[model samples]
Target chain A: MRDSRGAEFDDFVRTRSAVLLRVAFLLTGDRHAAEDLLQEVLEQLYVRWRRVQSSPEAYARRALVNRSINRWRWRARRPEQSLGDHDGVARDHADTVAVRELVVGALRALPARQRAAVVLRYLEDLPVVDVAAAMGCSEGAVKSHASRGLARLRGALAESSLVMPITGTGSSR
Target chain B: MTMNDSDVRGILHRATDDLVSPPGLLAEVRRGGRRRVVRRRAVLAAVCAAVVAVPVAGVLDLPGNAGDAPIASPLLDEPTRGDLATDDGYLRQVRAVWQRQIAQSDDPPRGEPNIVWAGDTPAGPAAYVAHATVHGMTVGFVKPTVDGPRVSTLTQVTDTETDGLEQAALLGPQRDVLLVLDFGQPVEFSPQLRYAPGGKVERTFEPVVFRDGAAVLSVPPQRTKLTVALSRTPVERENMIHIDGTSEIYFPDHKDRPGPPLVRYTLPGAEQVWGIDPVAEDVIAPTKALAEYLDPVGAHTHNGSPLLWVYGATPDGRRLLMETVQYDDDPSHVIALLAGPQLPFEAVASTTADWSAPLPVRLRLPDDQGVVVVAEGSALSYRVGDGQWTDAGRNAALLPATATEVRVTDANGTTTTVPVGS
Candidate 1:
C-alpha cells in the first residue's frame, strides 16, 4: 500500500514538475536557488502528500512565496549578495534587460505579506478572496497587502527608467 | 483599467513577462478543479501518520521529481585560499573533535538541547547567549548532531534558568553544571527562572519549529526563585537582512537596524542553516560557522545580475562557496570552492548601482597582507590544463586557486586591479 501510494504520488510529481519549476523561476529569478526552494517546498508537500493532491498549486504557491520572502529578508542582511549588472554589458544596454530586473526588484522590495498579496492578485491573477485564503489571512488583510505591495512596487519602479502603473489603492476595486 | 499608476503597472507586467517559462503556469485554473479529487484521498491517508494534513490547494500541483529541472549540485571541491585567511578553520575542526567526544560520552544529553543563548563568545559582557534548555537530544546521527556540549561556553550567572529541582553548580568560569530534567532520547527540557523586570531580559529568537510542543529544561532550584511565564506569541524576525531577487543585491543595513532586537524566541532544530542572499563582501572576511549551498547549474549571465554564488562557514570555521553559472548544461549542482585559510572568502560580493559603493569587507586579520584586484579589458580565457592567465582568448587556462589580485576588463577596453591593504 505504501509503495502504491508513493508511486501514485511520484507520478503526479513527475507530470507537474516542469510547471512548478516555471512558477518557481518567476517567483525567485535565481534558477539554482529556485530549484532549492522548490525542492524544500515539495519535500514539505511530500510530508503531507495526501492533503496536497487536492489543491497542490495553492499550497505550493503559498509555500514558495513565504520561503522566497524569508530568503529575501535574510539576504538583505548580507550586502555582497545583491544582483546587479555584472555581465559587463554597456550601461545603455543594461536598461534593455531592466524590465525583468525591475519587476523582480519590485517584487523583492515588498514585505513578505505584501509580496504574497501582489503575486497572488497580479501575477497569479487570483481574486482577493482566494489570495486571502492562500495566505491564511482575512480578505481585508489581503486587500491591504495588495494595496501596499502595489504602492511599494511603484516606488521601486520609479527609480529605474522603466516606469509601471499600479491599481487598487485601498478601497474596493 | 485606467489609473495614474498605469505606467508602473505596465512596466511591472513587462518585467515579469518572460519570467515564467512553461507559460501554462498562470492558466492552471482548470487543472485545479481536477486536483480536488486528489486532495480528498491525500488527506485521508495523512490522518493515519498523525501528520497534519495541509489543505489540498496548498500542495495539489507540487513537483515530484528531484531533477525535474536541471538541478545545480549543492556540493563542490573546496577552493584554494589566497589572502584573507584566519584560524576559523579551527572552529570546524574543533566542532568535529568535540562532536566525537560528545557522542562517545557514556551519559549523553537527555534530549534535544534547547539553546539558552547563542552569539559571540568568551562568555563576558560582549558575549550573548540565545536561551536555556532543560534537556538535549542525544548527539547522534539521526537527530541532534554536534560535537561536545551543545552550548560552547556558559558566560554569566544569568546565562541559564532552572526548572523542577535540578541544581546549578558553578563548574568554572567557562563551564557551568547544567542539570538535565530528563535523561533519555526525545527528552524534554523546560526550565523556569525568575527574571527580574528589567534585569530579566526576554531575548526573542526566530521561530525554530513550526509545530508547537512541550519542552522540558534542567535548572537549579535557586534559579527558579520566580517562575516567569512565557508567551506563545509569534514575533516578527527583527534585525533581518534581505536579498532583492532581480538585482541579486543585499540590503543589510535597512531602516530597521538599530531597533530593539529580539534576543529569545525560537529553538535550533534544523539540520543545517542556509544563508540566502550573502553579500560578496560579507563573505570576504567571514566569522565562524557560516557555510552556504552553491548551485553551479543556476549560474547565468543576466543583464544586471550575472553570477550568483552562495557560501558559508559551518559551526566549524570552514568557509565554502556554491559557485553557480548559467553556461553549464547541468544547472542543478554547484561547484564548491573552499577558499583557503589564508583568505577565507565565503559569499560573493554583490554589485552596487554606483559601481564603487563602499561595502563592509571583513578580514580575519586586517593587519596582515590583503588581496589585490585588477580589472583588465583584455579578454581572459583558460582551459583545464593551462596554469595561469594568458592574453589568448580561447585557450583554456588553469583557474587561479584562490581569490587573488586579478585584472577585470569592463565592457569598454579598460583594465585595472586595485591593490588592497589591511
Candidate 2:
C-alpha cells in the first residue's frame, strides 16, 4: 500500500509536472525560479501527499500561488533576496521564442497578486470562485484583479508588432 | 490595444507552451521528503528526551525561548561550520552584506546576522549557514559573491528543512557562472552534468571537496540543455557511462490524465477495427451513433488484453475512431480509422508508443487519409507540406495526409508547433 501510494505520487508528478511547471513559469516569470519554486512545493507536497491524493492538482496549484506570493513579499521585505526577472535574458527573434518572450514580459510587469489573479482566471480558465480559492481572496477581488491585469496586459502587448485585437465575446465570466 | 479574455488566454498558453518540469524532480522531492521524515523523527525523540530531562528553568531561558528578550536571533545558537569558518575578514564581509540587506529590508532582524559557513567553491567565493530572522522565523541564507549578494535563493532554516545536501545554482561574483551544489550525504558521489546546446554534447565533471555535504560547481551561462548523472561510489574517469540522456533531446511526453477507463462498448452489430483510436476528433458527434453501426470489434479479439476503443468523427459526416488492435505473436498497437454508414471501418493509422504531453498523439493514416493530432490545448491547427494551416476543430484535428506539422496559434498570432515529429 505504501509502495502504491509512492507510485501514485510519482505518477502525479510525471503526468502533471508539465502543466504545473507551466503554471509556475507563468507565476514567477523565470524558468530557473519556476523550477526552484516547483521543487520546493513538490517536496512539501510529498510530505502531505496522502492527504491531498484525491485532488493533488488543486493542492499543487494553491501551493504554487502561495509560494510565488510569499517569494514576492520576501523580496520586497528583504533587499538581499534576488530581485531578478527576464529583463536581462537575451532576446530570441525566432517565431515562437519572440512571442513567448513578449507575453512573459507583459506578465512580469504586473504585481504578484494581480498576476496570479489574471493567470488563474484567464490562463488556467478557473472560475472566479476557484481563482479566489487559489489566491486566498474573494471573488470580487479576483474579478477586479483580473480586469485590471487584463487591461495592463493589453496596454503592454499593444506595442508588439504581432498584436491582434480580439473581439469581446462577453463569454469569459 | 483592447483585448478580450480569449486573447489573453491564448497568449498565456503560447508563452508557457515550452516550459517543462525538469527531469529527476520526483527523485529530488522524495529525497527531500525522506530527510524531512528523518528530521521529524529526530525532533520527536529529542522532545521526549527533553521532557524527561527538562533543562532547568533559567538554563532553558535561551535568547528565543524567553518571551521578548532583547537577545540575538535564535539562529545564532549553532556554531558556524565550514572550512573557512575561522576567517574573520571573510566572515565580516558576509556579516556586512547580511546586515546591510537586513537593515534596508522592511522587517529587519532584531540582532546581527550569524556567519555560519564560508569557503571557496567552483562557483567562486560562497557562504552558507548564514542565518537571519524576521518575526521569529529563522531563514538560512547563502551569499555567492563579493559584488552583489542575493540571498533570496536560499531556503529558510526550519525544523524540517534538511541541513544536508543543499543544491542550488546561484550567481557568483562573475555573474556569468552560477552553480552551487550541496549533497548532504557522507558518501563521495561523483557528480557530472552533460551539457549539449544544439552542438556536440560535452560532459563537464565538477571538481570539489565534499566538506560537510557541500560542493560548488560552475556552469557556463549559455546553456541550451542539461543531463545529470551521479555515481554512488567513486569510479575511474574513463570507466563511467558517458552517454547519459543526451539522446533524449526533449522531454518525454506523458498524458496529463489517463484516458477513460477501457469499457466494453457493446453495439452487438459489426464494429470495424480502425488501426488506432481517433487521435484528433476534429469533428465528433456526442452520441456513439457511429459505433452503433459497426461490428463488435472487441468481441472478435482473441488475444492479449481486451481492446480499448474511443470513438470520434470527421468533417464530412463519416465515422472515425481509434482503438487497440492485437495480432498473433505481435504486440498490440493503437489504430485510427474512417467509415461511412455503408462501409466497414478500416485501419487508417496507428502509433506503437504511449500517448502523452508537451506533445500530442500524431498519426498519419495509411494511403494518405490525413494526419490526426490530439493535444492539450484546444483550438489547434495543422498544415501539410508547407501549406497554410487549417483549423483542426478543437483539441483534436484531422489534416491532409501530407500534413507534416501541427501548430497551435493563440489569438495574438503566436504559433507553437505541437510535438508531432517522428
Candidate 3:
C-alpha cells in the first residue's frame, strides 16, 4: 500500500507539475517563485495524497492558482516589468518567441483571475467545468474571463504587430 | 494578434516549453518520502509488537446512495464528501443553510433577499441568496414523509435558470394529478403525482413519463415575486429543464455583498500568507452599524482547511480585526489589524498600532552588515561601512547583514545585541 501510494504521488508530480509550473510562472513572473508555488502545492498534495490522488492534478492546479492569487495580496506590490521584446531570450523560432513574448506580456498585464482562466482553458486544455473548479467560480464566470482575456491578448498583440507573426502559421522569419 | 482558441493554445505551449523542472527536485521528494515511509512503518511495527490485537468496529455512515444509487456516481471522478444524503437530504441541508443566512442577514427586516435552492431528489441542496427582481409567482415546497419506495410523487415548476428544477410528492388522491406550471416552454405537464399514501417505500420512476416534465405550462403571468425550489443537488445536472415562455424574466437589481480586495505575496519568507484591502469603496462602503457591533468569533477551518477566516469588525470604524482562523491553532494571536477607525482598506505599506505590537527587541549584527530594525510605524535602515545611525536613510527597505560583529541599529541608532531567531 505504501509503495502504491508513493508511485501514485510520483505519477501525479511527473504528469501535472509542468503545467502547474507554467501557470505559476505566468502569474508570478519568476521561475523561482513558480518553483516555490509548485513546492507548496506538492507539499499540500503530499499531506492529502490518498484523498486527492484520483484527481491529484485538478486538486493541485486549484491549490496553485488560489495560492498565487492569495499571494498577490499580502506582498509588496511591484510595478510589472515587461520583458523587453524577448531580447536575448528569443531563440531560433523568432515568430514562436515573439508569440511567446506576446502571451507573457498579455498575461502579465491582466488581472489575476482572467489570466488563470485563459491558462486553464486554452493552455492546459481543461474543460470549462474544470477551469471553473480551478478558479472557484461559475462556468459563466469562466467563459467571461476567457472572453476578456482573449480580447486583452488580442489588443496587446495587435499593438505590438506580433499577432499575425505567431498565430498566422508560425512561418520562420 | 487576435487569436482563437487554437492560436492561444499554440502560444501558451511554446511559451512554457523551457520551464521544465529543475534537476534534483524529484530526488529530494523521493528522499522525503522514504524517510516518512520508514517512520510510519516503524510506528506501525511498534504498535503491533506492543499490544494484543483488539478489534475496533469502523462506523458505516454511508448515505442513502451507498450502492447502485443514481446520484451515487459523482459527475466527475472526485466524490463530493459532505451532507449529500439524497435529493431530500440536499433540500434539508439547503433549507438549514438558508434559514441561518436569513436569520443572520445584516439587512433590515423589510429587505428580504430572494433565495435560490437547487439539488437532486434524494441528494444534498445548494442555495444562493440574490437581491434580484423576478416576474411571476412561483411557489416551491417539499412533500411530507410517506414510508415506501413507491411513494414517489412529482410536481413541476417553471423551468428557468432562477427557478431551476422543481420536485414534489403527491399524497392521497392528489398522487394521480400531474400539476404543471408553464411559464412557457415546449414541455407540457400531465396532472399526476406518484405516492402510495403512507409507506416507507419510494422507488424511482421516469419523471418524463409523468406530466411534470413540461416546457411551458399555463399560469396568469404574475409580476415580480420571490422564487424558491427544494431539490437534492447542484443545478449543473438540471440543464434540461427550461422555462421557454419566460424569456422576459429579468435578473435585475443584483447587489452582491462586497468583500475586501486581496493581495498576494510572491517574495520569500513573507509572513503574510494572504492580505486583503478592506478599504475599497465597494467593500466596506457605508460602514454598517453592525460593523461596530463586531466581536471575536471562535476560530474554525473551511472545507480545504486553509488558514483563513473572519472574526469581527470594530464599531467606531478605525480598525478591523481579521484572524487567519483556518491557517493555525489559537487564531487569536494571528489577528490582522486593518487601518480603519475600525477596519481600513489594504494599502502598499500599512502601520498597525492597535491590538498588540511586536515587542521592540534590540539586536546587534556583525561588522560587515549593520543591524536593520523591522517593526511597525518605524522604517528599516542599514548601511555597510563605518557610518553613524544617520548614515542609512530611515525608509531604507532592505539592510545587508554582512560583517561579523554587526550592529542592528533601530530606526533610532540606539543599538542592542540580540540573537537572530531567538
Candidates 1 onward: DockQ, in order? 0.11, 0.20, 0.11
Off by over 4 Å in 1: A1-32, A68-96, A163-173, B1-422
Highest lDDT among the candidates is held by which one?
2
**DockQ for candidate 3:** 0.11
Decoy 3 TM-score against native: 0.31
lDDT of 3 by residue, B1-422 (tens): 35666766766766765454432233334433443444355557746654543345333322221322122111112222222323565445444544443343232122233333232222212222222112211223222224212212111111122233232222222222222333223332222112222111122222232222211112222222111111212211112232211111221132111111121111111123224432211122121221221111111111111222222222223233332212111112222333443343331111111212222322222232222233322333333355544332221122344422223444455554323221
Query: Can you write out model 2's per-residue Cα lDDT over B1-422, one digit (the tens) per residue?
Result: 55667777877866765454443455555655655566567657756666656654323333223324433433355566666677787777677766665555444465556665566665555565444445333344455644654453333333423332333343443333433334342222223332222111233343445554354444443222322333222422211221111212121121111112222221112123333333221122211232222221101111223334545555454566665433221333555766776685655556652333323356766555556665433457776667787766644455666667778654455667864554
Worst 10 residues of 2 chain B by lDDT: B293-302
Compare candidates 1 and 2 on lDDT and give the better one. 2
Rank by lDDT, highest first: 2, 3, 1
For residue B95, what is the lDDT in candidate 1? 42
Docking class of 1: incorrect
lDDT, residue B323, candidate 1: 32
lDDT of 1 by residue, A21-66 (tens): 5455556765446555655566556656678778877787778777
lDDT of 3: 0.39
Candidate with top DockQ is: 2
lDDT per model vs. reference: 0.34, 0.52, 0.39
| Candidate 3 interface RMSD to the true structure | 19.8
| Runs in model 2 lying further than 4 Å from the true structure | A1-4, A72-93, A165-173, B43-422
